[model samples]
Every structure is written in structure tokens, then in C-alpha cells.
Target chain A: MSERSPKKTDTMTEAERDAYHAEKMKKKKAARDKILATKTEERGLVIVHTGRGKGKSTAAFGMVFRAIGHGFNVGIVQFVKGKWGTGERDVLEKFPEQVTIRAMGEGFTWDTQDRQRDLAAARSAWDAAKAMIADETYKLVLLDELNICLRYDYLPLDEVVETLRNKPRDTHVIVTGRNAKDELIEIADLVTEMTEIKHPFRAGVKAQAGIEF
Target chain B: MSERSPKKTDTMTEAERDAYHAEKMKKKKAARDKILATKTEERGLVIVHTGRGKGKSTAAFGMVFRAIGHGFNVGIVQFVKGKWGTGERDVLEKFPEQVTIRAMGEGFTWDTQDRQRDLAAARSAWDAAKAMIADETYKLVLLDELNICLRYDYLPLDEVVETLRNKPRDTHVIVTGRNAKDELIEIADLVTEMTEIKHPFRAGVKAQAGIEF
Candidate 1:
């Protein structure tokens, strides 16, 4: 029997635990290697971050930042944020050669007031996005809040899906916003829903500069 | 009946849709402004990211990137990731004056297998975190994977909670890991559970360099 029951690990002697742990790791490594062997195909990923919580766009930008770390050319198309001077935008804009950001939305639909204008902005952003996707130099493209525009039916679903389906083999695309559609989820390789458990906003706390933006 | 149904927006004439949308936005803005009026108090927050999903640490680092955008001083204590040379670490470390990162933990429990050593590492990381919290210069502190230590009882829950409770009034602290304790969530001003809807690893996709790291 194994003496390294995680809960009772501290109770065991160091020598006893180390030997047991080492053997366990050996088995784990073997099993992992087998899995890795089967994972031979390597290509870009279609990632989605959604749900009614924070970090949907933030997490996508995190990936963009990581891509920047690797010296990868990146593109960001903000479908609804509309050049709001967000903190992420300020930092990312510093790397102009490595990153190109288009904040196309006037604001949320309510702020825009004109359905025609909102639709125009969405189309403009989508056009920018398609161009970026077609460019082989860009390794990663972030479609920030594209899901919101899709949720509101600003762009045709088929065109967007078709573009993603035909994206370059080595290009990675991340879509962020709440309420991702069924078709998008169906094609995504990874999806994370940031669920709000508690928010300071409900407790009468206003949004802060760096933390919220 | 109103003519600006979101799904039917493109079908309506520009004049008709603008009038309807404008009226709707006016009422919405009034209601929103009322809520904004009540949210007058401003202070730093205790934020927690936990769940069995991805993006807990990724989202936390995203905030770090945003903070860097504003030139806010940040301290990152990575309890379990160790010095794996993660992409976020490489990028954030570029701004040495603005950010200090400590990748303390050796590895996951299974990888280390030394219970005593893991305990020692956790204590060391916690000590560093406490020092960061006490230093008034740090505007934001990210306790990366601290919840995993707490979940495994490596560090006393009460001490962690107390330190966070007494953190500087304007110093925001973000704790990230899956299975966050209820006590931690209870005191947190903002809590988000990253729910995993889908993952590439499940489909035999290996972790990509910049995207996963």
C-alpha cells in the first residue's frame, strides 16, 4: 500500500515518502509519455473565453502578451470596447511593431444609440480581423469582444466561422466575450467560462484605474 | 411595438431604428447613472480566481500586464509554478522596476514527492508574500497558486486570511488557484470561478509554447 496519501503525507517519514513519491512519478511519467506519443499533430488552436464574468478579454489579452513575449506578431480587433483607453491597450500599444490594435466599436450598443453605426463599426472591426487572419506574419490574433457583436447579431455567423475554419495552420486565434454561440463553442479547442462568485461592484465599490481597465 | 429588436436591427430603416434605439439608450443610461451614483466609495480589493478551469493564473497575470500599463508596482509570488520559464514571467520580468516575481515552489506535489520539502517551500513563499503585502510600495500583489497550498494545508488558512484582511487599504491582492477556500472567498471583494467548458489536452493536444505557458 502507498504511504503517500496526500492528506497524510506529513505523517510519513521523509525517506519513506520520497521513495514512494519517486516510484509514483516514474509511473506517471511513463503514462504521460504514452499520451504524448499519441499527440503527434501540432497546429494552431481556436480558443474561446466566455461567460458572465470578468477576465474573458483580460485572459485573451494575457495570451496576446505571452505571444508578445515570444516575439510573435499579434493583431487585436476590439469589436465593442471602442478605444476606451483601457490599461491593456496602453501597454500593448507600446509594442507597435509587434502588435496592431483596432478598437472599432463606438461603445456598447446603448452608448452608440444608432444601430446602423454599431453595425458599421462591427463590420469595420471584422474586416480588420479578416485581414489579420489572412496575414501569415501574425502568429496570434485576438478578437476581443467579438462574441458580444455576434451575440447581438452584428456580423454574419457563417462568414466568421468560415474564416476561422480556413485560418493558417500555425496561426492561433482567441475569441473573448460573454455568451459565446453554440457553433463557435463547437469548433473551439479550449473554452473557459469565468463565473462571477462575488464582485466589489455589488458592494458599492467603483471601478479602479489599473485593476478594472 | 418597438422596432429595434436586436436580432431585427438590420431589417429596420435607419430613421426608425435610431429613434427607437435612442429612446431605449436614454432610459438605460439614466438607470445606469443612478447605480453609478451610489458606487462612490473607492479602495483596493481582495480578488480570488479559483475553479477546476483554466485561466486562474493566466487571468491574474493579465491583470499584472494591465498594471504594468499604468506603471503600478507589482509583486508576484508563484507558489507552485516554480521557475518553469513561463511566458508571462519572461514578459513581466522585463519591467524590473515595476514588477518583482518569486517562483518559489519546486513543482507539483506528485513531481516533488517530498512532503516536508513542499511544506518548507510553501512557508518560504508565504513569508515572501507577507513581506510584499506589508510593503506599502506595492500597489498590487499576486499570490499565484496560493489556494493550492491552502487547499493542501501547507500553510495555515487563518494566517493567510488575516494578512489579506489587514492588507494596505489601497493595495489590491489577487489569489489564484483552483478549489479556493470558503473563508478566503468570504473575505474577497471579487471572486471568479473559471469553469472549464472544454480543453485541448482532453483531445490529445499538447500544450503549446506561448499559448499554454
Candidate 2:
């Protein structure tokens, strides 16, 4: 345990404040060092981005760019959102060798209004995703909106879980969408559910080009 | 509404699949044009990121980079986390002119274990945040981990809410943390909750440098 520093006030002199901050940071460093010493394992992860809130897919796209920053090859399979022209897709597509994207869905279920067609698209997307998972060449694969497919039973949950369970040891996979199945959550190494606390749509604010898409 | 395209099989000729995809995309373009026509209003937003999951702060950081891509100046105030060396901080700090960051907290409540000190830190951070909010030069201001400060009652909720409610019309504000207050959510333009579905820490996997921090 680290010792707590004395309270700081706005009236403190600059030198005094700096000295206090330095002392506090030293204690924090010691505590952090103790924790870091025990954590040494590194491996690929099965990450899930789910919930009824925005940014599940957006966050996954952010990770794609982060992974690219580290010079990792990436693959993206869109299971529900296929109609919109996203800025991320345009930017990522420019890196042909490092990125492979397959937008397989016609649209969301409500927009398409065709169960059989939605199922077909999901199956096709799943096929593409499985191939990416098996390939060690791609370090990260983002299965965008795959949870919608599973929630609607467009694809078998058991099979999807089994495939993810058998993914390459060093391949990270991120699945995004709302209503994620329990099985997928159970198998995922990291899962984030986006809760809808407040929404601009309710306030009559339309989604913007760069912000939303 | 657009009609659903007929299902295509893997056996379809390359040219046939291409033609089908092109036709579908054309219909999608028309539908999208209709929606885009109605979305003419543009203004600043009060966005909230809350939930018991990873990526709440990560997603907010992503937006900072995205805003930078559009040539917008960004200000970041870390209310609870200030001790760790985050990769984003290092990168964003390089662009000193475009990005201004003030990591104000000594640490989290559990780490600091001092209520009066925490309250003092929160007040100081809030003052800095209010200054950023009033500055017209910053297009986006991210109050990182602000929810934690509010959750602990370190600052007055009414004052924070009123300030955000009266923010500049064209300046966006993003507040990230878990256990967001209901009053803040009520006034927010967009709210996202990151639910913890799975966490690698629970599985004994250590947080990575670029990934977690």
C-alpha cells in the first residue's frame, strides 16, 4: 500500500503544488509497479462489443485503426450494416494489402424485411468470417454487427461459438451489435455492452457523416 | 422502401454477382439520398459514455483523433486517472497546438483513499473543465472519467449539469465513466453505456500497453 499525500489547495504556491504532485505520483508509481510485476502474459483476445447504445461498431472501427497503428493486418466482415457509405470503410479500403473488408449484408432486418435473404447474407458473412479467423495472416478480424444476426437466429449460435473457440492462438476477433447472445458473451475474453443512457435521436438530432457512420 | 434482391448462390458467375451487387447498391443510394435530404440540421452535442465495461474512455479518445482528422481542436481533462502513462496521452501530447490535455487527478478513489483530497482534485479539475467548455477555440472537449467524480459526489451535480446545458452551440462535449448520474443523462444529447460482458483481467490476462492504457 502507498501512503496518501496531504490535501492540496488552490492557494498553494506553484512550487508547493508541484512538490506535492511529485510525491503523490511517486507513491502511485510504486503501487503500479507492484501490480505490473505480477502481470506478464500476452495473447490474442476474443472481444465482444454489444449493447443498445451507439459506438459498439464505432469503437471496433477505432480498434481497427489502433491495430493498424501497430502494423497489424486486419479483416472486417459486416453482417448487418451494408448500405451506408462509412468514412472508416473508405479510409481502410485504401490499405488494400493490410485490410480486407467484406460488407455482405443487404441491410438491417427492418430495412430488408426479408428473413430468408437476411439469413443468406448472414451465412455468407459467417463463411467469410470463419476463413479470416482460420487465417493466421490477419492479426485482427472485426465481425461488425454479427450479434444482430445471432439475436435474430440468422446463424446458429452454437456453431458460431464453436468456431470462435477454435480461432488461431494469436488472432484477435471483435464482434459488434446489440442483443449479443449469452453463449458468445460467455466465450468472449473481453465484452463491452454499450448501454443507451442518452441518445441524440430522441432529441431530434440527426446522425452526422463523420460522427455516426 | 427498396425491394430485396433475390438470393445469389456461390455458383453464380462473377459477372452475375457483380451486376446484382451494383443494382442493390444503386437502390441503396436512392434510399440513402432520401434520408440525407432530411438531415440538414447540425449543432454541437453533449455526449455521455457510461457503463461497467472497457472502451468507455477508449471510445472517447477515438473521437478525439477523429475530430483531429477533421481539423478540429480538442481539449481533454482526466478527472480520475492521472498517474498511469497512457499511449494516447503520449501521442496526443505531441500535437500540443491542436490538443490540450490536463491529467488532474492523483488517482482513483480506492488508490488515493482520501476523500477531502479527492474532492479538492475534483474541484480543480472541474475548474479547468469549465474553462475548456467556455473556450470557443476547442471544437470538442472530452471530460474523461467525469462520471467517477460525480458518482463519488466530489462536485456539485447541479452546477455541472447547468454548465453543460448552457455550453456553446457548436462545441461538442463528451463525458466518459461508469455510473453516470441520471440528471446528466437527462440533459445529454447522446449517451452510451459500455456494459462489461467479458473482461480479460478476470481471466488472468494482464492489460497491454497500447490496448488498455
Candidate 3:
């Protein structure tokens, strides 16, 4: 897989390649136009990012960055990663007015052994999330690691699903964590399960500061 | 779910909550420290992003952005998407010293009808990718939509796999596209299949400029 083959351009004339590429692009444009014409609606979305892979929260943060790039205000509530100082948090916090980030969790459930305490934190975080959902000012609300909290039974699943269901029609909401509940998945407008095929952790690679965070 | 439940905090004194939280965090820190102690290796990764849903390329770009935040040089070779002007490309291009981007393909197979031309483009893109991989200056190399090119038989699967196998040890490479070849997946260090449960396209929402591009 490591060796490079010779360039194929030597065999084809410039004019021949140009003519072929043009004709090809023409057909593609027509097919694309037909598909684009059929798509016409726009609204808020209930997007759930869950899986055993590494990019669930990373992807959610990417969306937050993307939304901010579009000059949209975003609210981020961390459900299980409050203790770690992440690179994304540092970058996002630079935009004070456009981004509001509240690190609510003490840590993961296994780390915080007290069920009662975990439950309290989850409740408080969910309350904050609901407030953001109701606030029309926020274009996107990210519930970071909410799925893990739900999986641990720290928060009631039914209530969480219902609140997501009733969020403002124009405010996109993103929930990210592993082991997303079936109930939440059912109500989500877009659900992505990031299946992990390989992990560096198993190969003895410790989590890096910027990459893992 | 829309209604707020009574705060459980009402039953516990502030002092009690603080003590409980402090105790729980202490235990968590110990567990986390234990896990962190055993993880010690650091090496580059062969990452693959594929599936039916969106975010394959978005996630790859997110990593590139994250890497750049850490002052790492990155090379991006787009194998299938060159016609559209993307927001990520615009943003990444601002950092000329840290990032090198090559948009090689005219479009996808549907857009470019010439199989021979597509093959030539894929080969050219692969050559660019090999150059980046061999150059130790690049910390990460992203082959955007290379999987699609391989899937469509525009590039040889074995050759691509062999090339990836021989890349620099500390240089990470990410390949993004749906329907990745099994051979690539077999040798990848990490693979994520972004399963799509729901999409706005199905609801008649057209791909918006900043959001989609």
C-alpha cells in the first residue's frame, strides 16, 4: 500500500481530458439539480450523536463551531466531562457572546460513586438544558455526554425524550454520548451511532490533551 | 417532559451536598488515575470514516481543525469533491503555513462520467497523498472521499492498502467516504461507521450553504 504508481496523465492529451471531464460534469449537474429541486423545507433538528467511537462529542463541538461560523449563538451543557479542561472549551469560550458553555458534571458515573449525587448533578444539568431549549436566542443547544447520564439512569429517560420533543421548532438540539436510549433515538430527527472499529487505548496509547479532550 | 420536576436538592442541605460531591469526586479521581497509569504508548493512526449518513467529511475536517489548534501541520487531498466551494476549505486556506489542501477530483462518479478520467484523477490524488505521507513534515493527512474512488474501481484497492501500510509511523491519515473497501477497513487502526437514523434531506430540507458545504 505504500508505493506510488506512475502518473497516468502522460498517456492522455490535455484536450481529451478536458472534453471528457466537461461532458461528465454536465450529467452530474443535471442529476444533482433534480435532487436539489425536490428538497425545499427547512426547520430545526433533533440530532443525536451516539456510539462507542471517539467522535460523538467531537462531532457535536464541530457543529457548534460550524454554527458559530454562521454567526449563530450556541449553548453547550456538559453532562459528564466537567473535570477535564478540553481544547474545544478553551476555543469556544473565546466567543463569549456567541457561545455559552456550562460544565455541570463532576465526572463520569464510575468516577463519582454516589448515585444520589450523580442524580442531583444530572437533574441540574437537564434543567439548564431545558432553559436553553426554551430560549429562542440559542440557535443550537448541545447536551454533551447526556446519553451517558441517561444510560447510567442518573436522569429519567422519558422526561429527557419529552423535553427534546417539545423544543422550539427553529432551535437545533444535539445530544451526544454513548449508549443512547431507544426512546431518545426514536424521537431524534437525526441519529448517528459512531461504531468503534479500533481504539488506541486498547493498544496502550494514552489519551492526548488536545486530541482526546 | 416539558414540565420541571421539583429539585431533589431541596431535601439535602447545602453542606451535605457539598460533602457528598467532594467525596464522590475523590473516588473518581483515584479510578481515573489508575486507568491513566496503564496507558503509555503514542503512535500515528490510520482512521477511516464511512457510512450512509453525513458527517464523514465533517468529522475529518474537525480533526484537522483540532490538529491545527495544536500547531500541527496537516495535508488534505480531496479525492471526490472539488467543484463546490466549502466553508471548511475557505477557513483552512487561511493558514497557509500549517495546512496544505489539494482538491483533485472534478466531482463524484455521478458527476464525472469518464471512467478513465476519474481513474486518472484518483491516481493523481493518490500520488499527492503518497507525497504527503512520505513527507515527515505533515502530522496528519486527510484523503477525503478516497473510499468512493476505490469503491467505484477508479483506484486499485490493493495498491491503496499497500501505500497506507507503508506510511510514516507518527503521521496519522484519515480516509472519509461511504462504502469503504473491506481491505482498507481490515488494516485501519480505527474505523467509524456513521449510521444514519434520520436525515433532513428525507424531510425535503435542501443542503444549506454553510451547513452542508
Candidate 4:
């Protein structure tokens, strides 16, 4: 065997190690204080839900219910899907002022033959979303099916990111849809991937009310 | 001459109503067909970053980044904190897979404090959150605070919703922090709550890291 030289290890000196440890300790203390101080200040929560998997909107609705239970005002703006046999419309409509709902009735891209109308509706929705973000009237804001708009070129991704980045310090925003872009993910504090493994559709089933709808 | 009550207008018969509706056709037939044919098809989205908030889980990171660029996953789950201090954390320690991050931490509650440990430790993080709710293996789940043990009597309210509720049909889960509960919001699909709100403490502030330890 060709004589392989012994591997070398980089070791820190005592002084270097001590300094490093001290720095780490400092960071730890800072973090602890931050956690302690966080109890008093108000901040924003941003959510982005997207993927080929099912139940994205359903998940959002669950959070909405939880937030409401905790006494929070919520706002939902449906980007591409407006009218259909959706259970969300039925249930949310019945809620008190604790929740506000808005939708773009143009439906999906292929349905809205007029490109201008789709773009205009998206712009209008964006304007409303901007207002909500600025006003802080609602504790939570849900942008339902918004990712589709970004993917379909209905709304500029840049503007969406900019708005979210500068949104009110206390209002929470949730963006949901498939084909989420990378730019939006960069600015976000958390990210998740929903990879489709198995689906009931492959077995030939139908969308049912109160479950799939 | 007195004001008369308004007369009832003519009402449409069943046949008339059917006729009126018969003329109105759905605009996007093919898309509707596609949507109708697949029972388990994914259409829409939701972000659930339900996990421990402090000690740097960054539940919303992956989702926010994905929305900013093309080809990114989107989701979030802030399980614990209901308050602030994540802004700086969001600015740092970003991962490509994270899209959106939202955390809710309000420090530790004392009355129910453990006699064994005074400060929080990462190793014991999972203990506080209700298992099914804080499990972050989903596309998004951010158990923010959750450190109350049954002995502490900090967790309660209702049965855990379960991972099936808010979790994406396909994704990873993100569980953070201490005492997970029974009524843990298990069917969460996504779930999170602040465990340390209104924590008893002195007025002057100084957060130490590693051990408050």
C-alpha cells in the first residue's frame, strides 16, 4: 500500500478555546434574555404553505380556529379560488367579527380567459392584503392560494416579499399554494417541504364535503 | 292617504330557477373536470410551524424563503410563544429548506416550576410540548414554548388535535421545547401555543445564556 501520510487535526490553543467558549457563553446569555424579554413585546408571524400534497388550506383553517379560540381577529384573502363548493366559506362566514374573509371569484388561471382580469383581481387582492398588513386590525392574515398567483404570474413575487418583509410588527401572515418560489423562502424565518408520498386519488376516490372540500 | 306596505314581488318557480341556472355554464370546464376527478388531489396550501419558539428553532424560516424564489417548499409551525423577539433570529441562521418562521415563547412559569431544574435545556425540549402537536416532522410544525409537565399542571385545554389535522399530506415535522401535553392539539394538521406567558420575574433585565443555567 502506498504510504498514506497521517491525517492532521487542527486543534485550538487554550487561549483560543477559552475565547471561543466565552463568546458562546455570551451568545447563550443574550438568547436567554431575548426569550425572557419576548413575553412583553408583540411580533408578527409569517406562514407559507405549499406543495403537491393535499390539506394545505385545511391546515390553515385549523390554525384559524385555534387563534380564534385564543381571542385573535383573523383575515383570509383567497387569491385564485373564490366561489365553489368550499366548506371554508360556509364556516368562516358564520363566525363573528373575529374573522374577516375575502376572495377573488375569477377562480383559476385557465378558467379566467381574460388575463387582464386575473391580473387586476390579483392586484386588488394584493392591495387589500397590504392594507391589512399595515392596519394590524386582524391578528392573523391568511393569503389562501397565493402561491398559485406567483407561479402563474398574476402577482410579482418581489412585491409580495417586500410587503411581507415590511408588514406590521404584530400582524401575522399566512401564504398558501403550490410551487412556492425560492425568493419568498429566503426572507422567511422557517420553511418546510411537503413531498407527496401516497394519495387516495391514485386509487380513484372523490372529493367529499367537510373533508376534502 | 297613508303609506302602504310594500307588496311581495313575484317569486321564481322551481322550473324557472332551474332554467335560469341552466343557461349559466362554468367557464373552466377542463380544470373543473380535473379538480372533480381527483378526490385526494392537492390544491391549496397551509403553513404550520408549531414547535418551541425560543432557543432558535426558527419555525417559519423555510417557508418564507421558498416563497421568495422559485422551486422552494413553504410552511411554518410556531408551537409555543405567543409574543416577540424572533426578528434578529430570523435575520440570522437561515436554512434553504425553511420558508416561514413564527415562534411564541414567554419564558418559564414558576408556580409549576420543577424542583429538579430551574433553567431550560435543549435536551429536555421535547418534554414540554404535547408529542402529537409539537412533532415537527410535517412540512411545518413549530412548538414554540411548551415546557409544562403534568406535575407542573401547565398544559391543558383539550385533547391534542393530532398530526393529521394541520400537517401537509406529505412533509416533515418540527417539534420544539419542554412539556408536551395530552390535550396537545394532536390532530393539529399543525398546532402550537405559548407555555410561558406572564412568567413571574424581577423587573430589571439581563438574559444569560446556557443556564439562566
In angstroms, the error of model 2 at A106 is 4.2
Model 4 interface RMSD, in angstroms?
A: 17.1
Model 3: per-residue lDDT, tens digit, A1-213?
344355544466867766665676687789788989998877788888888876787777667767766778899898875533445655565578889987775645555566666678888888999999999999899998888888666788888988999989888898988888888877887888888877777777876644565
The CAPRI quality class of candidate 2 comes to: incorrect
TM-score of chain B of each: 0.90, 0.86, 0.85, 0.30
Model 4 CAPRI quality: incorrect
lDDT minimum window of 10 residues, candidate 3 chain B: B1-10
Per-residue lDDT of A101 in model 2? 90
Candidate 1 lDDT by residue in tens digits, B1-213:
123344556677868877877787789878888888899888999999999988888888888888889889999998885423456766776789999887775745455656567778899989999999999899899998899888767799989999999999999999999888888999999999999999888787787877877
lDDT of 3 at B148: 81
Best by lDDT: 1
State TM-scores per candidate: 0.90, 0.72, 0.80, 0.46
- The candidates, ranked best first by DockQ, are 1, 3, 2, 4
Better of 2 and 4 by TM-score: 2
A65: Cα error in model 3, Å: 2.6
Candidate 2: which stretches are off by over 4 Å?
A1-41, A82-85, A90-98, A105-110, A113-120, B1-41, B65-71, B80-100, B105-128, B151-159
User: Per-residue CA lDDT of candidate 2, range B1-213, in tens?
Assistant: 233235554566756655564566568768876766676678889999887788877777767766665667898898876522444555565467788988775645445555557777889999999999999999899999899888656789889999999999988999988888888888888888787766787666787644564
Q: How accurate is candidate 4 locally (lDDT)?
A: 0.48
**lDDT (tens digit, per residue) of candidate 2 on A1-213:** 223235544568756765665566568768877877777778788899887778887777667666665667898998866433445555565467778998884744444555556667888889999999999998899998888787665788889999999999888899988877877878889988787866676555777644665
True contacts kept of each: 0.66, 0.34, 0.46, 0.05
Identify the superior model by DockQ, candidate 2 or candidate 3.
3
**Which candidate model has the greater TM-score, 2 or 3?**
3
lDDT of each: 0.83, 0.76, 0.77, 0.48
In terms of lDDT, which candidate is stronger, 1 or 4?
Answer: 1
